[model samples]
Target: MTKLSLNRRHLLKAAAIGSVALASPAYLRRAHASGGEVNIWTYNNFVPESFKKQFEADTGIKVNVRLVDDQGKQFNLLAAEQPNPTVDIMTVAGHRFLQFIDSDLLAPLDTGRLKNWGNINPTFSESDWSTIKGNKWGAPILSGMEVLSYNTDYVSAEEARTWDTLFSEKYANQTAYIIQDMMSIIMLKMGYDGNMVAYLDKPEEAARIVEEAKQFLIKHKPLVRKYYDGGAEIQQMFVNQDIVLGHSWNGPAAALINDGFPLDMTIPKEGSYGFVYTYNIAKNAPNADNAYIFLDAILSSPEIGAAMTKASGYISTYKDASNHLTDLEKKSTSFTDEELASLQFFRAEANKMKYGLIDPAVEAIKAA
Candidate 1:
């Protein structure tokens, strides 16, 4: 597990200066005048320092950030702190929200409190993951997709458009990917629906499909150089010329491309899985009002969204965020309508069974 780190010193310093800022007679107050702190737990780089400073400056709300490196770890910590979570807001993936909801770790959002809520893209706001049962549990902020990426200097665009390129004899030992994600995409390439929830009623069919994908991966195991876990690991592999083709999250590959690397990513002919990351207020948060204000500030400006996208390489959820992006930034991050339509967004109902089948299968592939 990745070590979890907290920026307590920064939070302490912010708190120390809070009284001084409040004492200023000329201090400007924004739409929400509640002056308090909002403690956030999110992945590194997901929150830009510039945005954080700007948010504090504009609203006088102190932002205390804690960096969580692993999703499972974050969930565990939140569970352990139940009923009195230290985090006011945290980032949760669309597919993983169900577990948090079932555990009663999240608070239902009152969108009426967020004055800039209308700036959210309908594609995200209308998703089943965002609205559970009749309550809005989270506000979608960014999205990323699994993609086929390759070094353009070595792999042709035509070759990189299909998942088969990773297993081709021509690129043996030159490919890499996260094992579970690779298995999922291979299933899609094999003409399966890739919807695990639909197979829950028929566990036998799910088992059969998973076994097939497992066997296929074992057969092509020699073609792969490594099965990586994190984005940074894969990015470094590409930089060191250890991998010329691989499966990757669009964000890491986009960051490389934007940095003038001879790399590019595609959705592939078989389509791919995508997920939206959202900001949710914790249940029984001490500063729920401040959390609402923080969410509103994130949605209130296209420039904030743009800065977030540039920092993290994820597509922003703000409707007009792209207006502030450069052509290359847009090219690396934004998807066309056709491409968007081809993606299968991760579903909450499928979370358990999807991992149940895929996890053991991946371990078997690794062993073989």
Candidate 2:
């Protein structure tokens, strides 16, 4: 297991934080073919190790987690393997949820059985991601937002608030932004925000908007140290002083800040980009019955939901969970009503064809 997959801190915390008083399962739900091991596919960094163990202890089933090396690659792989899916539980971003439904790759989710179903926040739990194909591809647990993160030892929040600071000569070689999922976000500065209801629905128009973002970023590149895909690498760079300011997610930034490293999650003037890492069940999964158990454990149990977010970086979308998180999780976790109100997430489906498909425009921006 990778460092990310094996995280035990949150589970240790969950046990202490959550009142584990529920009656033990009266009887394991009758499995379709008898419950066995469940397979989970997601990136290594975010899956909490504690979640897997506690869940296993409760249900007497094993979770075989597969690491998804790249987001884009994983999406295509699932789309192609629709009929003969391998993994049982998939933790994917919301935008990708729409794609999964489009490909007819999933089974309808029955959240009614989940114990934690009532704990999830309405914003994250709503039927938004439950698509037209009738399969609710993902059940969102946490919402993540990206903002300009800066090392407070060197830069000030006020200084990093505007886009101009990145373009300024002073911060040159000291700034960075994300590449894969933030084109529409940057376009917000150009007055072309991601109203997926409008922009994502029109690919050509989204492409034009992306072009403008490229123009801004290409010039901003000289001032930037690098472009990033969300991971430990960005935080490593910040800690080492390789870059002073970055476009990064809430968890890492907050983690660094709470660890006493000089870090700040700067909310830029134009707003921020957002996404939710949600739980989905794979069709033809090897252990889907167990998968359902795992999903319910997370969605319905406030204790599990809260502890899951405490361990993982993203904010838990469950509204009813008890929070036993560290001060950092309390401060930065995005799932709460207060945090949601403060956030400005981008719309899904709108810029998807243009940004979601990795068309020429997105590649051009990356290559540039």
Task: For each candidate in the order shown, give its overall lDDT on alpha carbons.
Answer: 0.80, 0.64
- Model 1: weakest 10-residue lDDT segment is 18-27
lDDT of 2 at 366: 66
Candidate 1 lDDT tens digits, 156-214: 98897778888999999999988887777877888885757778788888889989999
lDDT of 1: 0.80
Best by TM-score: 1
Question: What total of clashing residue pairs does each candidate reach?
Answer: 0, 14
Best by lDDT: 1
Q: For candidate 2, write residues 1-368 as lDDT tens digits.
A: 10222123443344334333332233433323233788888764445565566556666778787877455677788877767878888877776666566566666677766765666677667755545455456787777787777777777767877756766888888777666555656666677665446664567776676677777777666677877765566767776677888777776676555455666775677666677887788778767778877777555456556655554456667775535565555775534453345356554564356545435655776677
* Residue pairs with backbone atoms closer than 3 Å in model 1 (clashes): none
Runs of candidate 2 exceeding 4 Å displacement:
1-35, 127-135, 199-204, 334-343, 356-358
For each of the candidates, the C-alpha root-mean-square deviation to the true structure, in angstroms, is: 6.8, 5.2
